[model samples]
Target: MSSVLLFNKPFNVLCQFTDDLGRETLADFIKNPGFYAAGRLDRDSEGLLVLTNDGQLQHQISDPKHKLPKTYWVQVEGQIDSTAIDKLCKGVVLKDGLTKPAQAQATSEPDWLWPRNPPIRERQSIPTSWLKLTITEGRNRQVRRMTAAVGFPTLRLIRTQVGPFKLDGLALGQSQLIKQTNLLK
Candidate 1:
């Protein structure tokens, strides 16, 4: 049987086990050996990271061809309107090309959210808003770029779900090992 590790990666922590620059990494949080990350969560982003001991499972989870939907709760620099939400849902033209249509909507800040360390910078004159965005493709800084393309820069991003796994009930910088059979539930 394969093993899966669900990690709630904290901000500024590298997704890999080691970093040449002496930055915080998965090694600092996950002590389990023989497990490798299935996908990457950017260092600046906080959220669920899936790791697996089986190579085939890793490929299935990370491969864009699988089209596993990943969801994020984003805090943008300005109040987002329906127009921006519509654009995000329809597909935003990116430098790489047009992004796949995503599920996006303006949302209220989640009450269960934890405060980010070294809080995001605030501009008193410009109000911020929240968005729930789900995308099936993983591109470098894609979420940030998508929001920027819609005229709202992301100030903070927290991934809440990846496929059937979620960050729910997992605390910051924590890791939980799960039996492969339990993944679908």
Candidate 2:
């Protein structure tokens, strides 16, 4: 049977198991062998990172062709307005090309959220707001670029869900083994 691992990767941790620079990595938390990350999160971003022992399952989860929706809770530099939300939903033009339409809405910060180790820098005059954005394509730094293109730069980003899996019940730096049966359904 194949095995899956759900991990709530903390901010500033590398996705890989080893790092020559001695940065914190999956090795710091996960000790199991044969499992590898299905998808990658930037070292600066945090949220649900899926790992699997089966190579076929890894490709199924990480391949963009699957069109699995990834949701993020974004803290932006300004009070994001409807216009920006609409732009995000309508597909913002990026250097790479126009992004696929995304689901976006202004939202309040989650109450269950944990504090970051090194807090995000804040501007006294510029207020920040939260947004819940969902996208099917996982382009490199796509969310950050999209938000910035719409004039609201991301202050902090935390992914909350990916496909059927979620960050629910996992604490920062925590990892849990999930039965394959639970994931396939």
Candidate 3:
């Protein structure tokens, strides 16, 4: 059986097990050896990060070709409108080329959300809104870049789900071992 760990990564934590720069890493939260992160979340983003001992399962989860959609809850600096949502859903043109159409919707900030350390900057003059976005491709800073392309800069980003696994019930820096059967789902 493969050892699958579902971790709720906190903001500023590096996705790797170790960092030569002495930053907080998976090692700080997970003591279990031989497990590796299936995908990466940027240091500024927070939430569900999958770690697995099975290399095949890791590839299936991380590879974009598999099209395992990852969902994120994002807080943007502006009051996002339907047009922006439409653009995101219709595929926005980015410097790296046009992104594939994604599931994007304006949402209210989740009441159950944990407070981020070094909280996102707030401006007195501008309003902020939340969005729930799901994308199959995991490009570097894709969510942030996508929102920016539509004129709403992301203030906070949290990945709520990846494939069948979710960050629900996991606290910051907390982790739980998932059954292989659940992972297969």
| Number of colliding residue pairs in each model | 0, 0, 0
* Candidate 1 worst ten-residue window by lDDT: 176-185
Clashing pairs in 2: none
TM-score of 3: 0.97
Candidate 1 RMSD computed on C-alpha atoms after optimal superposition onto the true structure? 1.3
Error of 1 at 157 (Å): 0.6
Q: Residue by residue across 96-148, what tens digits does model 3's lDDT show?
A: 99999999999899988999999899999999999999998988899999999
The window of 10 residues in a row where model 2 has the poorest summed lDDT is 176-185
lDDT of 1 by residue, 136-176 (tens): 99999999999999999999999989998889989988889
TM-score per candidate: 0.97, 0.97, 0.97
Task: Name model 3 segments beyond 4 Å from true.
Answer: none
lDDT-superior candidate, 1 or 3: 1
In model 1, what is the error at residue 26, expressed in angstroms?
A: 0.4
lDDT of candidate 2 over 13-82, digit per residue (tens): 9999999999999999999899999999999998889999988888888999998999999999999999
